[model samples]
Target: MADQDFDVVVVGSGAGALLGAIRAQEQGLKTLLVEKADLFGGTSALSGGGIWIPANYDQARAGVRDDLRTAFGYMLRCVRGMASEDRVLAYVETANTMAEYLRSIGVPYRCMPKYADYYPHIEGSMPGGRTMDPVDFNAARLGVDALETMRACPPGSKLFGRISINAFQAHSMLSREFKSRFQLIGMMLGYFLDYPWRRKTQRDRRLTGGQALIAGLLTAARKAGVQMWRNAPLRELVQDASGRVTGVVVEKDGRQLQIRARKGVLLGAGGFERNQAMREQYLTQPSRAEWTATPVGGNTGDAHRAGQAVGAQLHLMDWSWGAPTMDVPKEPAFRAIFVERSLPGCMVVNSRGERFLNESGPYPEFQQAMLADHARGNGSVPAWIVFDAGFRAQNPMGPLMPGSAVPDSKLRKSWLGKVYWKGETLDELAAQIGVDAAGLKDSARRMTEYARTGKDLDFDRGGNVFDRYYGDPRLKNPNLGPIEKGPFYAMQLWPGEIGTKGGLLTDRDARVLDTHGQVIPGLYCVGNNSASVMGPAYAGAGSTLGPAMTFAFRAVSDMLGRPLPLQHADWLEQPERAAQRPAERMAQAA
Candidate 1:
């Protein structure tokens, strides 16, 4: 074929692909970025948009001290034994470098100082400052010409800055009189106004998290002169006589075009969470057919299949990051488990009507527990988040719908299933939910006894610091409150996910390698298209986006044959001291 040009061709337009394109452009390599979807961003645009980077420079500046050794230890414990030590080490070490690179490219970032890993009690876990989230950007800033090309989070949703499940629970714990009603009103108003601002600004020019991140890198890529193509899908990877990849066939505008790559082809097309076949086969949950949290229309595991076609090895394909979701009526899209504001004393029960877990735990744990219950023959098909009237009046369970702006209505008419069920006694509610009424009544009675004494003897639900983080401090019983009230509530929940975690297996350099541990020449993967750096487990806040962007940056540096500078060491040495120094204070004041 004719030399169809460009030094590197990046597949997919998520964080990884965009980062790779930016890096290639920075290296002055002619680059091309192709997206199968009409819009860019992929799932990254639809996510909470946090990046978990432990021991990052921003933490040091924010009076948090975390070293590589500590971060590495924490990561290993977080992933259990699934992730290779070298891979974890490489990711943790390069986190700051990646964060700095993005900042240099004008992607604004903020440190989440109070966020903890999903398992805080795990050895080596940092209390805070392990995650970083992007500052909410004004979509209008990217300019009108770029607006139509960008995508935003689903309509009617707003992501609060550095907000944690615990923080939200704390807010929900306030008594009605002590509540910041006006602040809540203001928050709702801000969301409405901000939505229009993003839309109106984009009318002239579009800018958003996914757009801004991509646009910033696109600008850098353009300056470095990288060629990018939208609406082009890679049909297949072409190989040389030696069985090495040399080019790709792309289908665009009803025509087939063959483009040769002299260096490499990176597949960051994201995972197959939205693909019904893959979801049914791997997840084995009927709810997989309805999940809407993925990149609305296009993520179908194209990269996984394409790479597999060339003998690329795969890892963690049977596992996912895991999510607790609720099924909605209008669409199959699943919403993340909105831990009912009333969960302090509530318990999650499977269809068998047995309490499976503490409802206040992290989402990953909740998902895993539910899956296990399903395995034990509890029927994962219809699990329920059971709570009481007292719980409902306190907590906010997130927006009524996945992408909606409205708060969930207190009445059952607005919710799915029988959100409200009443019985004069605990036995009635248990029978209503189809669990072993005796088991449930016994469980509730025991729990009530423990609550009267301010303890959860059975599950130790609120005994831990992590659990207390979500508990109502003012309540006499933080966790074991009785469910003796007349009316109880149970909302149906299903397995939901931010995105799938399993994909192409790559090394520290983000190069897709085969089973023999040989790099697939001209093949690379990043973001959700590759196995997560965190493995099967997820950490707090920005876990998904953090590693995605970090790997993307590393992939770019690897493509450029350059080392990311560890400049933060100068600032990291005695991070606390440096942060507290008088000169730094003066600098901030100035």
Candidate 2:
């Protein structure tokens, strides 16, 4: 193979990938990003695009105070001694600094409104300021060719036609007021203009959320003169005689080329979410590949496998950024589950037809319950996510758009039975869903009683702000309605993830660690390819992206031998002024 040389070679094109490349180039290194897929961006382009910076300037400028100590405490409590204390401190100390660096490099962020910590009652958790969202980016800024190269949002994410929305708008649209209604129309109108225009041109000028995050980073990378190549999958890691990684061998144009890196190779490539063999090998209770939300064959864990083959330390090999998703044949990835589980009249159950968890809880927690149920020695692999006719009439259920009939084809049985099942009565529904009729009846009756009392004796469904965030606010107990109406429906769910969290273990500087705990001199990893700093818990929104980018920033800072910037301004050290205390961030967001 002929040698293609550079100072740094970055594998992956997600948030961590692009940022590392840009930072490398800024340090005057000949850095380039190699992406496996035809498109540049990975799951980061399809995500909510939240970065959980502990003490961000956005919070400070908005008068939403947050400090390092509190954020660190919250994280410590959330992880419950699962993660490295030093790494946690490193994350808290450097989070806001990374935000500042991003802003300096032309990526801007805003504090998301009313985004609560997954576990708000935990010691360091705050209602907000633990996360920052990238400001909306204009695709036109990337020029025609660049705009076309950027990936679009996944199938089930958009509304109407070419439209996209944020978490705030997704929640607000559920409200009954004309204000929410009018905002929806106005936003949809913007996309309506582009719908026809996109048909004839390469410019899809409007970008938001994940698209904006990737597009902005790509723009910055382009401005810094960082080179990027798509359809260039990394074949293997190339190392020197001394066992230090020198570069990579990539399969491009049906040929393997040895690309040399003088300094190091940063592996920001994502996880093995779509690799079925890996899924069964690593995940305790894995979902089928067809049901996953990850892009088709995008995150098959090539970088992780390469690192492992070279003796990279592997820890946290059992966890993921778990999400409950279903199949939408039209949707290339998984059918999104963001709002459905929390909407009124919905509940999830095991094969025994008993309610197993608080359906409205965060997806990771929900998945944890499912795995626990599976481990209980009963067959809980295909749990049923059920709701009633009234619920269906009121809210959209997964990819089944609101006010649309359940497709006739999905109701018919196949080798897998029906993925989506419907029945006119509780007994018939139980029979179709393959559950005990008596168990289903008892659970339904209990939920009905709890609905009237505004209390869920079994799981306390609507107890928290996070639970109510996706509910229809007009209801008396937003997340506690009954599944009493006829024509109930259920969708089978298995253990799936937004992406896998297990990968090559890294130290504070993001250097990949060997099996014996020694650093692989010329190897670093960020994003999902590195052992997550949060360990088993997701502390807040963007927990994955936050650590991914921060460590990418840390990896670059270490590579360039620069000191990390101070986390926040000096005045933020004051006790009372630190962090947007309690409910204040919600008001600030409003």
Candidate 3:
């Protein structure tokens, strides 16, 4: 017997879970969203909040040219058959519609015209305008209590870990554009002027990045009257004799409760990145929980374990949304180095002091390069970003910030020996960081020469539009500048990820599939809980969240028995391996 009932029970409180709950509730279903931790918003709240939707309504309104066919072609090339063609097609075709739906529901997604695709050289890749970010939202709208309890954005995502700035502002400021100075001033003034909220919390009420995205979704969920439960850790799936998922057992208030779900259960609880044991069993070697930048409390594979117990097949468990993270002293979590690596006058090198990859490339590829080099016994697991005083003056390095804004004099004395290593000469820097001195000197000289010649002879650092997107525009090659200035520095970088990618495999409609590739009726998975739609490859900036929210929308639509979109209906209807109906499969087994 069930203790309580609802049309849907949503596990996890990230962007996808909240959006799914909202959609289900708005469609007249009694939806309940549950989170294991007391704090709402999983890794999604800690993310950059960029949503990549090709040919989105916002882009069209802004007169940016794009189409489904072009996006499909580009993604197909990027993933190289690692992902399902149907799934890829579903995302490309339905993404624009999903974006339109979000806007209708009050998610203010504004297109970022300069945010180029990670692989712009690929056929059908657009120069920019495929990615959109949620505009800054006032936290006061969600009320003081909600704002106080929400998971805060990471320090790397904010200005000095306090002030909020939009994605566009971050780009301009990081690139050190002339207009960015005034923009910063205006932002500081706006934040300080909010005197009433300032007294209550140091956190900026003007939310940006993942904070804003989750705030918007959380607001929608509340408005739709979705029942939200905190500290309710899902224990197991409840199924009837026929094997149809009907409810879930969750620990609430230190007691297990069986809640009946009339429609289905959504497992949106995030990946296993934070679980050290899971990391050892499934992921590539040399990975660690300490390396990940996800929130500290949860996302330890609760959904994956529960789904696997019921015969749900898992795929791509070894892959992740990899990024190089910097270890800041005394910080609870690592800070991912995203914008800093692309700036001029710096290079990432292995212990042998050899340049291994194009430092200015996309973050995932950057970490992949590290792991690949480490696999070859080059000791690239803890690589170092070698930079001179010139680079320090122009850019921020992890938590160090810019030298001009925060000089070495302002840095903590404790940080000098641990957070970073400083040297008056290249050889001295190499010695302090335990790298080959000769190799360091040679690499620095080569980079200096490349900056003067406007050509990266080795890795072609600024070869593409994507690489140059975050680079310094004042230089001949935005990604190349002389590293000859005295007083060099080195900071450690680990192959860290925002979240792991592997989990329960699902179909185009976001229905969980069993071992035999049949749908497990009344079960759906979204976000990091399911196998990523993009497969092993990352498409663009918002690749993770875009598919997450899109499929969440699709899951609710399928739950309501809504018809598939007409344009892609033909391909979608033709499943390569025909999935049997759940009841039919159960009867066959009997």
RMSD of 1: 8.8
Candidate 3, 432-483: lDDT as tens digits: 9899999888899999999999899999999999999888888899999888
| TM-score for each candidate, following the candidate numbering | 0.82, 0.91, 0.96
Q: Taking the tens digit of each residue's C-alpha lDDT, what string does model 1 give over 1-590?
A: 63487678888887778877887777777778888888777777656556788778788678888777777777766765455555666688887788888888777776767566667777777767776766545444455565467555544233342111223323343333346556566554655556655555422122334445555655555555667678898788887877677777888898988887777777788888878888876664554645545656777888788888887777767666666766544432566753352346567676656677776677767777777778889775467666555554555453332212333353346454444455556666667767677766666666667778887665667766556555566666555566656466666677667777788778777877776667787677887788887876776667777777777777767667674544334423333432232224234434
Off by over 4 Å in 1: 159-228, 280-287, 338-345, 398-433, 446-452, 476-482, 563-590
RMSD of each: 8.8, 6.4, 3.8
- Sequence-dependent TM-score of model 1: 0.82
How accurate locally is residue 456 in candidate 2, as Cα lDDT from 0 to 100? 90
Q: What's the C-alpha lDDT at position 186 in model 2?
A: 80
| Number of clashing pairs per prediction, in order | 12, 4, 0
Model 2 earns a TM-score of 0.91
Report the number of the highest-TM-score candidate: 3
lDDT of 1 at 552: 75
| lDDT winner between candidates 1 and 3 | 3
Worst 10 residues of 1 by lDDT: 161-170
Candidate 2 lDDT by residue in tens digits, 30-52:
99799999998899998989898
- Rank by lDDT, descending? 3, 2, 1
Model 2, residue 560: distance off in Å is 1.0
**Higher TM-score: candidate 1 or 3?**
3
